[model samples]
Structure formats: C-alpha cells, structure tokens
Target: MTKLKGFGFKRYHLILLGFVTLASIATARIVQLHIYQHEFLSEQGDARSVRNIPISAHRGTITDRNGEPLAVSTPVVTLWANPKVLINQKSRWSELAKVLGESEKSLAERIEKNAQREFMYLERSMTPERGQAAQDLRIPGIHVREDFRRYYPAGEVTAHLVGITDIDEQGREGLELAYNEWLAGVPGKRQVLKNLRGDVIRDVQVLQNAKPGQSLALSIDLRLQYLAHRELRNALQEFKAKAGSLVIVDVKTGEILALVNHPTYNPNNRSTYSAEAIRNRALVDVFEPGSTVKPFTIAAALGTGRWQPQSTVDVGNGVMKVGRYTIRDVSRGGVLDLTNVLKKSSNVGVSKIALDIGAEPIYTMMQQVGFSTDTGLGFPGESLGYFPAYRRWGSAEIAAMSYGYGFSITAVQLAHAYAILGNNGQSSQLTFLQQEKQGPSIPIIEPDISHTVMEMLRSVVEDEGGGGVRARVPGYHVAGKSGTAKKQAASGGYTKDSYRSLFAGVGPVSEPRIAVAVVIDEPREGGFYGGVVAAPVFSRVMAGSLRLLNVRPDNLAQQVVKQGQVVRGGRS
Candidate 1:
C-alpha cells in the first residue's frame, strides 16, 4: 500500500477514509429522503400523472302530464386541446380539421392565436363516435370530455312550451329557462391517473359523487298539445297570418293543458332558430281583445243588479256616438237583450251597458278576471298586459274598453278569464306544473252572475244567428265569444287591413271542462273575422281535446236531435 496525503497515513487508509465518507453521505441522503421529504416527493410524482377532473352531471328530464318526454339530456363528448402542446402536432392538423368540419388553415390559426392558453375547446357536443375517432388519433394534448346535449322529442310541436337548451345543456327559453337550476345537476370531481399522452389510465379515487338533476312533470297533455298545434298551424296557413297563438286550460284544475304558437321553431334543430320564431306568443304578445269583452260587460251589468240575461238595450242602427268616436256593430241592431247583444256581438250594446254601469264595475270585473296582470306561471318574459286604471277612464275610454278595445291582454290571460267564468266565477292561480295539491280558489264574481254570463256566451255559440256558430262542437255545448280587432298603425290610429282575429271559449257548457283562447295575427287571406278564421280552429281543437280527455258529452241529446234520432223511454 502507498502513502498519499499524510506522512503517517498509508494509501489504503486514505482510500478507506474516502470510501467511508462517500458511504456516510449516501446513508444521510437515504435517511433524509425516506424520513423528511417522503410526503412532498410522493405528492410531486402524483401531480405529474394524477388529475382531479370534473365529472359531468346528467340533466333532468321534462315530461308532459301523461309522462311523455318533452325535453331530455343525452350523453355526449366535447373535444378540447392544450393549445401549447397541440401547436407542435402540425402534421396531424389536417386530420383534426377534417373531423371537426373546419378548415385546416383556420384550425391552425386558432391554435396559434391561443398559443398561450393551456386549454381550449376544439369542438363541443360531438357524438360519442366522432369524439372517439378524434381520441383514436392519439395526438398529444387532444382530450375528450364527457358532456350532455339537450334533446326535445316533441320537436316544434312542443317547442314553445318545453323550450330549448344551449349546447352546454343550459336552458335558454320557455319553461326550460324558468326551471334551469332545478334541471341542471351538480357536477362532481374525482382523481384519475393518466399517461403522458393525456389518456386516462384509471380512476384513483372519487372526490365527490355527481348529483343528477330532478325530473319535472308539466301539466300539459301531449295529445291536446298536438291537436292544438295542428289546428292552429292549419288556420295560420289557411288565413296567411303573420303569427298565431292558442291556449287551453283545464277549467277544473286551472292547469294549462295545451299552449301552442304558430311560426315556432323546432327546439331540436339549432339551424332553424330565429329571434322572431322563438317567442312564446301566447304569453308574450298582447292585443286588444275586441268584442270578446262584451260578455264581461254584460256580467258586470248583471252584477250591478241593473241588467238581467233578458235585459234589453237599444243599439240603434248598430251605431252610437260616445265622446268623439262612433261605435258600430256588424249589422243594424235596433233592440237587443243581453244574450242577443252577445249573439250579435254588438259593440254599441256593450258600450251602452258600460256607460250605464259606470267605469268602476266594468273595470273591477276586468281586473278580477286577470286583465292587466301576468298569469303567475313564472314564465320568463311574460308580459303584464296594459289595462288603464278606472280612475283614468273617460267616456270614450270606457266605451272602447267595453268592446275590448283601448286595452291589451295576452292570450293566456284571456283564456284564464274565460276559465274563471267556466269555473262558476271561482278564480285560481294558473300553473304549468302538474298539481300534487291545487291551491285554493277565490271568488271573482257571484256564482249567479257567472252562470248568467256563461248562458249568454252559450247563446253566442249555439244560436243559429250567433256570431261563433263555427265554434260549436258536436255532442257538446260550447260557450264562447269571437273578436276582431283592427291593429294600430305604426304611425297612428288603426290600420285599415291589418287585424287580429280571436276566439275565446269554454266547452261542454253543462259541465265545463276546458277554456280555450285563439288569436290569429294579420290574417291576409281567407276570411279575417274571428268567427270565420279563429272559430273553426277553436271548434276542431276543442272537439279533439274533449274526445281525447274522455269527457262525457253534455249535449248528446242535441246531437241526436240534429241527427234526426229521437230518444224515448231511455232508448234512442
């Protein structure tokens, strides 16, 4: 052995000392790593491969009263990319662009533009198969995220009621928007192991479990919805109207059974979307109700104990001067009872009745029947219709208000008013949700007054000379009123040709079950009168709905009599 550093020390001793120092350093490092830094190092390693990713929650399903699905959420996948990493995969750009239905140049530019961003959505709401194809490319930084897409099964038939959702499964309009939070579920998180390529290796642990959204059941009947939709669409086409709305309410439940609008878009088809087409016209569009308010006027007069069903009013030559305006009827009406006034749809008669009853009673009647207020359905963008206060009433204003002019109301509101009459003057809050327990109803008017008004309205539909003869349904008695209001010109006054045809009614007068209101805006073809254009639609829809609801016929004897069959001794 040779001596090196010290004179007394041998070379082997020096070598042994150097070996001991190296072994001691190695031993100290092992102890430090195993005892002190173990937790920190493990965390760092796990951070590289394990990720806490959010789990998409399932959205709720919306069903009609009959349990028919109106809107639903289906599983889908979204493709996102880490722009910083994806920018390097230039060779696979063309394949990615092809799968995304985008130009390769645009895709490249987007990635370059977002170079600083670690994550960006490449494509959202892709079908599972398409997303899997993109994932199969194995391009680094490209990832598939689980998501959901909203589906509307009834398409345009239930579009306005069920509404549509955005690509992210968020409700955008109609009832969907009103109930978004209830329908949107809580997303969860879990730790997952992934490889360097960003493909998930395994689920490490569940941090939180996803909470699925709650299911919603609407009060609508799908069968009646389809029927009303078909009839209103047909009427709009036949009349060449700009737009239309129809609403049906169960008189017993105060639950909206069917609500439909023309010029509506399919919620399922995003390409068919338009601002004008998406409006729920039944609740949003307001219009003067025209002669439809005559029955209410008669009811008001009756409530005053000054007029009876047979009380007569002189509508001389179908025209009368009130303030500065002249009111007229469809024809010369000399003397008319309250029932005949409704049967002939006399504006002058209602105006005389309003003048005699004063503004307070008429205004109170209108206000109590839901005019000038939203129906409390909690629908988004519902209008509070314009109803001038009684204190603001002049003679001219009162006259115009009598015949359903100088004020405005939504179709649903008008339907609700008629429903109040059908419910024997009992008024309840309206709802779109199926009732587990219905709220208590309040009396809007005396039951006798309501009954008298209902009988008068029945004469308007059933009598041969009645204005709403077309609204008659076979084997059932219908109580309703027809209205035609001239639209106000954009400049001033009223337009010469633009008109809104409306028909509001309740069916099976002996046992009222449904109240319906129809409004056709700007009908340029066919007959524009409410009786001609709107009543037929009301007839068809009411007939089909009554049959579909399995309502017993109240006028079967009249139907038999019209069919020339006589019933004797309980035999037909």
Candidate 2:
C-alpha cells in the first residue's frame, strides 16, 4: 500500500510540472512582443488602416470700409469614392448618379477609367442637402468631404474692384489677387483609421491644426460704389456708348471712394466670363486725356513766372501752325486770358502757351501729377500710360502734348492728378487700403499755382459757353476740365469716328473734398463732346457722394437765395 501511494504522488507532480512549463513559454513570448517587437507590429497595422488626410482651412472674408461683406466663403461638400471599392458596388451607381446629377453610364465610365486610382472625385462643390442625400444612400466606398465656395454679396456692382476666386478658393483678380498671400489659409494634416473599403472608421490623431486666412478691410465704400455704378450704367445706356468708366477719390485721404466700369460681369456667376468684361477699365485702360490736360498745361505756364491767370494770348483765327500739324480750337476764341483758355478748351491758345513755357517745365509738371507712372494701388494689370520724354518733343509734339493729345493716361491716373490739385498740390500715395496714418505728403506743385488753376477751372463749369457747363452742380462750386480725343487706331494714327470723352473735376471748390473722373468710349447717341457725354456722369456721382458723406453744401447761401427768389416770384 505505501509503494502505490508514492507512485500516485509522483504522477500528479509530473502533470503539474508540464502545465508550469507551457505557461512559462507563453509568458516569455508575450513579453518579447510587448517590449521588443511592438513598434514593427503597430507600423504594419497602421500601414493597412491609417491615412494622413488633409484638412482644408477657410479663406478670408473681404469687407468694405463700412464693414459690409463683399466676399465670403460658404461651406460646401465634395463627394469622392475609392474606384477599386466603388466598382464592386455597381448596383448603387444609378442612385448615386441621380444625386450627383450625372448619368449612370457616365459615372460608370469614370469609375472604370480610374479603377487603378484609390480615390476619385465623384462630385465637387455640391450643396449640403445634396451631399447628405449622397451619404444617406449609404453606398459602399463613397464618402463626403467638406469644402468652401466663394460668394460675392455685392455681385457685379463691385465685381471689378473686389474680383473673383477659383474652385479652390484662390483669388484670380483684383483685390483678391493683390492680397492673396494675406488672405489664403494654411491647410493641416490629420491621421484617421480607414477600413479596407476606404471608409473612415475613426479619427486617430490631429497631426496639425489648420490656420485660417486673415480678413482684409478695403477703403472702398459700398454706397459710393453703387452710386457710381448706377450713374455710369445710365450714362452708357443713354449715350449708347461702347464702354465707360468712372472713378471717385477722397481728396483729403486719397481713398478711392468708387470705381465702376460698363460691360461688367457678375463675380458670383462666372458662366460666361470674358477678358473684356472682367477688366477694371478705370485702372487698366489708357487714352489720350485731350483737353483735361489743359489745366496742367496752364499750371506749368503759370509756374514759369511769365504768365498770370489774367495773361492774354492771341489764338489767331482759332488756329496755329506747329510744324506740319495745325492746332485749332473747336470754336474761335480769338483772344482770351489764361482762365478763358481753360474755360474755352482752346487747342490753339494752350498750344501757344506750351510753346512759350518750353517742354521741360511741362514734362516736370506732368511727372509731379503722377502721370506715366503706376498709381501704386498694386492692382493686377494696372497700366502706366505712355508719356514721352521731353528730349523727344519737337514743335508739333509739344503742341499736341500741350492740348492733351500726345500722351495717354488711365482714368484713375487722371483722378489722382486732380486729387493732387485739389489737395493743395500735395501728393499722397494712392492706396486701396484704408489709411492707417495720414501718410507722408510730398509737395508736387506750388499750392498757390494749383489754387489758381483750380479757380480758373471753376469758370469751365459756372460760366456760360464753357466746355464743361454740364458739370455744374446746383449747390456747390464745381471746378473741372472737359476733353474729347479721337481714339488711336490699332494700326496707327487716330480713328475717325471713335472718340474718348473725358471729364475730371473737384467739388465744393472752396474746400475740395472729392475728385472725380469719367471716360466714355465711342458715344454713338446725342453728342460725343466731353461736356455733353462725360461731364454729366461726374456731376451726378459727385452730387450723390457729397450728399451721402453729409458734406455741408458750400453753396447753401446760393441755394437759399434761389429758393427765396422763387418763393417771392410765386407770391407775386
């Protein structure tokens, strides 16, 4: 009995030893995996399921000076699918195509064509509701991704100035392109766990945070923009003009209050965008300034100390000989003072004055007034119009330039020059951004000379038989110049019937607050004269802008007197 008992105990002990050995082996393997091989295994698993996805950042908002939103980014959705996985779910393609607004056969061909590509865009920039419908269909391998679409609230009214963006929300023109770097955002990275079918199962980690673009505040006023647009459109339709442009600048601050062009396109809807319609004509198109250059010519002559505002010149028979070309006035202003030379827009008188003062002084005055140079607005396609060097001027060239015929300038450039005149001959660098400080003012011309020229310009609007009488405002002292130039032909020389009608002016002459410029291209109705076609636009825009800004009417006394006279007449 003792021997049997010992044998049974030995058997039980052997069984217990075998069980301990197996447990020890299993524990050793587990330790090796958890400490030494763990990183490799985790990497292999991640390779199959983890993906680095790009996170889109929101584009910046563009606002006017008054905080009105001009451009904004609205949320949208994009539907994408993994072609390899999507090809297997062909049965659901018809339903998916219905939501995507594509035919089932087209969708099938697209999926087949990109079967090797793991991902393909099924639909881009769809509404949230459509995206949700696509998601609710719950087709395997199909997914929704968030994106943004650019929206323009002001539409075509501010199209040329504000500009437009592309499908990726990148600025393509105008202020948008000018400040693209400051307005574009940085995209981020994220790690997500995806299934074999390319469906995102869960988010693993936020690898990087997206930084949204900064907003831009422009100096443009929506009220003035609308007013300018309305008036310019009216003038274009009324005169049956081929094209037109209007620009309004704040005299004191050098801020562009309004810029509008005809044949404008809606930035919100670019289904039929064209290069011509998208062009900001006021800044991009250049033309001969014609009689608008008369003021500067008179100012240059005055600066020579040889001529006074009352100085008289003999415009013999309203015609003068300059080399082979003959300069003539529109009418016979046989003898006129310097002020009347501007008022009458005499091509003959101004040419004679320019020849007397010589070319260097005229060129110097032109340069000071920001001619033949960029306005420094940094706008894309902004032009620096052609102004020949003084060394190239002969008698004919001098005469042509004197009457504003030899050179070219954009509408904005003309407005800027007028602003300098209105601002007491101080040049403030032009900008589209609101002025943070007053900015350093550079003296461009003698303030007294500029004031004298301004005074002479007033006669052009206020006096009867003046060329710019159409520019007269009832309650303000309007000072301006009118110009009519034949358009240069593409081959050479000037076009016969095509003319550029221009008017540049400053309002409330006692305390100049705004400078306006209007250009009408090829007016086919009524008359093509600057006074008849372009001056009215400047007058209407200036009057509306002054009232909107609450500028105290400088002619309030005159208005009251006129009202009193009318009342008394009615009583009588």
Candidate 3:
C-alpha cells in the first residue's frame, strides 16, 4: 500500500499532463525560435512541412458567332500513382494495366519512377469511362485526376480552320496556331502539401487562381461550312478529282463565311492523318489561276482607263501566234469585246488587254488587289500568291499573264481580287474569323471601272450562250470568273489532258454581298473547261448560299430581260 501511494497519480491524468506539458514546451520552443531562429524555422517548414494547393480554372471555348461550340473541353481523367503505396498492391498491377489501356510493365515503370517522388502520373489523358472503371477496381496507390480535353464537335468539317491541339493544350495549326495568345488562357499553379502517407490534410492554401481562356467567337457560319463541305465532297466523288477547295466570304463584312478542303482528317481521331488532306488548300495552294485571272486583269485595265466591258478586241478564230507559242481559246472566238472575253474566258482578247495595260501595270494592279502579298486572314500557313516583280518580267511574260498564265494566285487571292469588285473596287483583309460589317469600303480601285466590271460579270452569269449560265440563279444576280488552267507535270512540261478548273465569283449582283472561290484540282476527267467543271458547282453553291443567306431576289426583271441580249466578246 505505501509503495502504490508513493506516486499518488492516475495513469489517465499523467497522460493528459504529458500532452499539456509537451504542448507548453513546444509553444515555448516556438516562441523562442520566433525571436531568434525564425528564418531557419521557415526554411525547415518550406523544406518539409509546407504544402501546395492548386486552384482550378477553366480552359477557353471556341464557338461560332451564333454560340455554337466548335471546340470545347471534355472532361478526362489522369491516373496518378504513389510508388510506396502502389508497391503494397503490386498483385493488382496486371489487372490495372488492362483497364488503363497500358501494359503492366508500363504502369510498373510509372509507379517505380516515383519511389522517391510523392506523386506521379501513370497516364495523362485517360477517358472518363476508363478512369471511373479504374476507381471501381480500387487498386491501391492509384488516383484519378480531372482534366479538360479539347473536343471538336463539328469534326473534320472545321478542323483545318479551328485546328487541333497537342496533349499539353498548345495550339498546333490554322487559326489556333495563328492566334494562340488570344485563345489560350494562363494556367493556374497551386502548391499542395501532403503527409508522409500522401493524404490530403483538407487544409489547402490556394497559391494562384488559374485564368480561364478567352471565349473565341469565330466568324465562320456552321451551316455554310457544312454546305460547303458537303458540296465539295460531292464534287470530289462525282468528278473523281484529285482534290477540291471552296471558300465563301461576305462581301460587305469581309468575314469568311466558310472554308472547305476535301481529303480532310478529323482532329478528334488522329489515326486518319494525311498531310495532303490536312492542309487548308484555299489559303495555302497557289496556281497559275488561268482564266480566273482574266477578270482581275480586265478589272485593272478598266480601272486604268485602258478598256471597257463594251470595248472590242478581235479574238481572231481563237488561235493566235504570240512570239513562238500559239494561244488558243476553249471556245473559238467571234468579234469579242470585254464581256464575251470573260464569258468565253478568251486568252486571245485578254492578252491584247494585258498588252495595252503593259504587263508591269497589270502586275502592279494585281499586287494592289493582294496578289503576292499576305491577306492577313489569321489562318496558319496561309501564303501570298506568286507574281514576278516587274523588273524580272519579260514582254512575253506580260502577254501571257494577261489571261492568267504567267503568274500564280491562291484561291483566296483570286477571291480577294474579286472582292475588290464587290466592295466597289475596295480591297479588305480576308478574314476566316467573323468581323463587324463595315459600311462601304474606300476604293482600292476606281469605282467606275469596278462598276463596269461588275456589270460585265453579271452579264457573264446572265448570258446563256456563254459559259457561265449554269452559275446563274433564276432570281439572284451573280458575277464571277472561271479558269481552266494547264497543269504543269511533275516532270517538266504542261500535261496535255490535266487541267485545274476554278471558279471565282461575287453575287446577288443587284446588291452584291458575297465573294466565293472554288478550285477543283486536276479534275482530270470530267469537264476541263472552267464553265463545265467549275461553273455548275458555282451554280449549286451560289444558288443554295443565296437562298440560305436570305438575300432578296429580283425575279420579274431577271425573267423579262432579253433572253440573249448579253454582252459578248469584248476586251478588258
């Protein structure tokens, strides 16, 4: 009894006192250290006891002007591992890999790498379904993290314009690559603290808030894009062409309504990738432009006071010897003036205009109309078309270039050049993204000349005997140019049978609003003439587009007009 009474203290009280005394001592030590060794304590805490907390933020959304989501973030799961903990559940390794779409060895390697690190990722972007399945399996040391994956709802139809992103969420192509800074938001960083067990303490100090990416509203219209894609795809199959491209832009706004290129790949599924198909041909490829360049040359000549739509030039039976090479027309000529020259796309008459204007003058006009210069469309890899400097050009070059032969132009350049006509001889930057509708464009060319060119182009569509009738809609007026250019062989000479058929136009002529360009590359078999191969496509596209755009039609006047009172065969 005396021995037991010696301590006179209960075990529970002693335990409590021990805790209280330890706390007091710890407090004293902290207070003393705060007075003397504050920096040292802070450094030690920073080394081991400190925690990191991450603040969540949203990625940007890419949408059409109508708020239709073109590119959006879909939730994904990232599988993480803690090697120390994972080792305890090694038995589940083989099973885990099957669910994760990875090899067991791959998973083992990921876990083993982090034997020292507290946490590491086994995989970065696993689909949500598989991640959830993994969680259900309840394998140890495994964690699923939430992340955003960019998804394109419109698929390949919009891929070339909207573009794709890498796994790290960087812009890769097209507009995405061009305006990356605007589209990408700042990533948030958080410092997280975990115990030795790697369990969250639930007391997190947020370091930085992630800035959400900006909302990108594109000018492209979804409906128009679909229509362009559908029509171009149909043309590819129907014509058995090597490839095709189409671009539609609003004349008033300069906004790109739609851009389509076939042999496209869906960004969502990368397995179908082909470099040839992935390119935005409308903006990237340049060609001699053939007869399509005729209108621009005519526009230039008219603006410079050298010619008029009613001006006459003898096209002499469609065959003429200029120097050594003979230039021939698809349709042999009559006494052609500006109108029939464009309608028949006559090389003979147009060459004469080019000669009048001088190759250098028309070449300068082409530059003014955006040839051989960037149009600043905000599309990745867009190129300025090729036109030789006046210093480098010869008289033969100038003569040949008059009818769209010596120089090359991209489809967009042709469209832009034609847009100057629609914009009343004003050239604005081509925009793939939408832009505010402008009032009237200041003249990039003489409006008087543009007016005549417009009139002549309208006649091209209205005249049934000429090549452009198929491009005419019954009620709406359309003005455009067509080209069937000789294709250069991969070897050296031009291919006798191969031709690049293209149509570039602007329409609802009464109140012209859109400038469209279609290029059917190597349409090799079906009709080689621009009117036959490209004009019908132009017809289907312009008609459907006008109807969709809600443009008013001038019906009775169009029907009552003299059926064949069309302007024919005139020089520029």
Backbone clashes in each candidate structure, one number apiece?
1, 0, 17
User: Which is superior by TM-score, 1 or 2?
Assistant: 1
Poorest 10 consecutive residues by lDDT, candidate 1: 563-572
Q: Of models 1 and 3, which has the larger lDDT?
A: 1
Evaluate all candidate structures by whole-model CA lDDT and list the values in order. Answer: 0.89, 0.88, 0.78
Instruction: Give the per-residue lDDT of model 1 (tens digit) for 125-229.
Output: 899999999988888889999999998889999998888887777888998899999999999999999987577889899999999999999999999999999
Give per-residue CA lDDT, model 3, range 480-503, as digits (tens): 777778888789768898888888
TM-score of each: 0.92, 0.91, 0.87
Write one digit per residue (lDDT tens) for candidate 2, span 157-218. 99999998899989899998999999989988999999888889999899999889999988
What local lDDT score does residue 63 receive in model 1, on the 0 to 100 scale? 98
Q: Which numbered prediction scores highest in lDDT against the true structure?
A: 1
Order of all candidates by TM-score, from best down to worst?
Answer: 1, 2, 3
Superposed Cα deviation of residue 398, candidate 3 (Å): 1.2
